[model samples]
Target: MQRRSFASAVSAAAAAPFLMGAAPSGGDTPASAAADKRLKRDMVASLEAELQDRDTARAVAAWIYDIGFDWTPATAPIGAFDFLIAYAFGNRPPANGGDPTKVLAEPGPMNELLADTVAQVRAKRTLPVYAQWEIAHFLTEKYNMSQVIAINPVIAADGTITYLSTDGVAAQIAEKRKSTPGGVGTAGVVGWRDHIKRCVLTTEGRGMKAFAPEGFTMPDTYDPESGQPWTRRRDLYLVHDMNAQWQMKRTELVARMYPNG
Candidate 1:
């Protein structure tokens, strides 16, 4: 079965399915770009502040992870991290030399930043595939095989896969886990088995359903390319990891959320 993967899964998205190409010319005015030095200062301070707390750090890490998946290493997370590190130590005297790894690995940052980054991702949730790429890309002379933290892949409903990680600035993210039903987000598992909450797509691939959840039933879903609407149909057994494909169920779905029986 296939499901949605993203930076976040909370709160329903916009009223209209993302208008795609362009708006009707009546949108809020866009802000001017920040100066490089100002951007650097803000980013460094944001990193430092975010790293102070475990939850925020994890969120930062998740951002890096999704960024990688969205753009691969063509968009490195480390440049920002290095910038933050340099800022932290630049004010200090030469004798108190700053090493990026040493500062990041210390107690104040470490796991604290990693975990916080996770929360930020969930809170700022949006369509993962719809994220920005040019804004994230950073040209580098050397390609480091690994950043500070490498993350698991978040597979899309269309067999698209994404891997996330950290840049090692003030951001550090602990490994995240979906430990409970409430933590399931859009994962195949829903509420309880006896009072199960589930989602399904029509065999004809033009309709959908999300049982028992408020605002989820017959949601305002649509195809990105054809811009067509889906028709409702009887529920299908949703077995296997739904992240693979929205309509692609690999195994016979069971009443239970676990064990794949």
Candidate 2:
């Protein structure tokens, strides 16, 4: 029900890419940053080159839809919903899953749809609560990834309610941090990190199974406060759109791999 602030969103976007390995660390020199940007541009161009053929688009779309549910956006920007649909169906798969080449195609209907949804949200002044519900609906209906919906609780017009899973609560907490100023280092972030460490990293939350994919396993150790161990649970925790930093990294990678056009 609460709306996220613009500043918090920007911070999340900036931090996410670094956490996901999409960008060079803040310590990089200006030349290195420029080179990285150039590489991303080239990657985008290459993908567009391949997508000149319509047949490629359809093929890429099908493959992306199939695997995207399990794909973590933290690993790449290809999970930007619309971009994923265009790239996998348009371009051939890269040797590595993180290849930007697969996502260089022009925007497709999926992109349009996402754009429209965002527009509507903005036009109607939709709050974060609404966005959360929309995300839950999208994940459940489109991908059959029930886990997404399971983690998000919903309140009905009639005052009835649907409960979200523990992981869902964790996600909400993460979203909150992304929407709040200095959230990544705030008490909320620390609390969420501790929750994951205790729940996903320790045996207590494991047996409860409130937030993981069915049959998902947790890692033996983690750096929850720092985003490490790269476990399945950690990936799930990091799977938030509010993390703009991650998104920027993904965009940069896409641009680097397909620059020129």
Highest lDDT: give the candidate number. Answer: 2
lDDT of candidates 1 onward, in order: 0.22, 0.32
Residue-level lDDT tens digits of model 2 in 43-124: 4345447877333333333323223322221111111111101000011222343523222223222223332333332233
Candidate 2 TM-score, C-alpha based:
0.22
Q: How many steric clashes between backbone atoms does each model show?
A: 34, 36
Give the C-alpha miss distance for residue 122 in model 2, angstroms.
37
What TM-score fits each model?
0.16, 0.22
Give the TM-score comparing model 1 with the true structure, all chains together.
0.16
